[model samples]
Target: MAKDDTGRLHVTVKTGGKRKLSSKLWLERQLNDPYVAKAKREGYRSRAAYKLKEMDDKYKLLKPGMAVIDLGAAPGGWSQIAARKVGSAEGKGKVVAIDLLEMPEIPGVAFAQLDFLAEDALHRLREMLGGGADMVMSDMAPNTTGHRTTDQLRILGLVEDAAAFACEVLKPGGSFLAKVFQSGADAALLAQLKRDFTTVRHVKPAASRQDSSERYLLATGFRRASAVL
Candidate 1:
């Protein structure tokens, strides 16, 4: 291991018998990432936890007693943070999460192993919450196919679906946050969010890698009465 400019030991991985170049590089990056180590130390599920933490700290997206929904939540990083922020453990808040994969139980989070894009998803979430949500968040991304345009479209599609769900599930004056990439949200999506929300913007938190194109689309102050489909 050699120290980088920040004096942090950089762990390097050598190409081995079965490991592909991409896998090797990914392992090396994970080993050397400070956020990964910090996540381990702090008992968080994943490094992506910091992304939501940083954004919520700055934007005040979460509040105690709020009802929140997490789309595509797995391994439960963001749900963990939201549960804490909303005091879900104390029964003062509620957090409902849905993902295609199974997730271990979290103290204050209700999880469903269901696909968010499924037709029954919105109904399931509403049943779980028993009411409208104060906030909806999604950190979902489609598997990349090495085609930039295709990847961008996939990312935007997921965000758009999440946004639509948010619009239907959130209470008046609620908020929505979802992951977007490349140049952030598409113009049409942004315009629609602006019509439904009081403010719409994109934020790239420090926890997101410098070279990464990931950005979070945040829309706050839902106006239920004037919202259009």
Candidate 2:
């Protein structure tokens, strides 16, 4: 394989091979993915870093020394980026990241291994934070069922849970960012975010595959229910 100017591999599918067409296509795309190349160069865990990087660049959410919570932070990509942007957990800035899979420790991030929707997860997260967070980001997506409607509902559930958790833990003027399939962020979730936030918008970062329906719902300015309602 040869690399292009962007560092992405120049790969092509062969006519005949033991690999199926799907497998060949997947391999070709992975080899050609710009985010994958950029991730390797940047030492980030996953290409997902570009998603957050793009989002942060657009929203100006991350700041040094801010307290942050990262839900579904697996492989530590977002956490790695957050650590550099938000400082270390033991430092003036704190980042608490939780995921079902264990992520290697990042210098400025505190990792918790558990299910975000588990019985004690929220309690433990709060204990770890010691107070409300300045920003809450969740890239959580449910394992797809292949059935479009089912998959959409499942992902939407994760987004809703993440949003509710953010509402509970985010300080006023805080921000919430979560991943959702384009069709999954229903009216209720959008309304809820709008009710609690000054700005609620859906964004599809360039890092996401063009064929994918996934996007991020970015909500800023948390207006606590007690204050607004």
Identify the candidate with maximal lDDT.
Answer: 1
Best-fitting candidate, measured by TM-score? 1
lDDT of 2: 0.86
- TM-score per model over all chains: 0.96, 0.89
CA lDDT scores, all candidates in order: 0.91, 0.86
Give a tens-digit lDDT track for model 1, residues 1-229.
8999998888889997999999999999999888999999998999999999999999998999999999999989999999999999999999998998999999999999998778888888888888889999999999999998889999998888999888888998999999999664398899989999999988999999998888899999999683322
Report the C-alpha lDDT of model 2 over 1-229, residue by residue, as the tens digit.
Answer: 6777787569886757589887888888877787888899989999999899888888788998888999989888898888888767558788999988888888878889988778888778878988778899998888887899999999898889998888878888899999888783399999988999999999999999999998888999998765311
Which pairs of residues clash in candidate 2, taking residues 3 or more apart in a chain or in different chains? 88-108
List runs of model 1 lying over 4 Å from the truth: 226-229
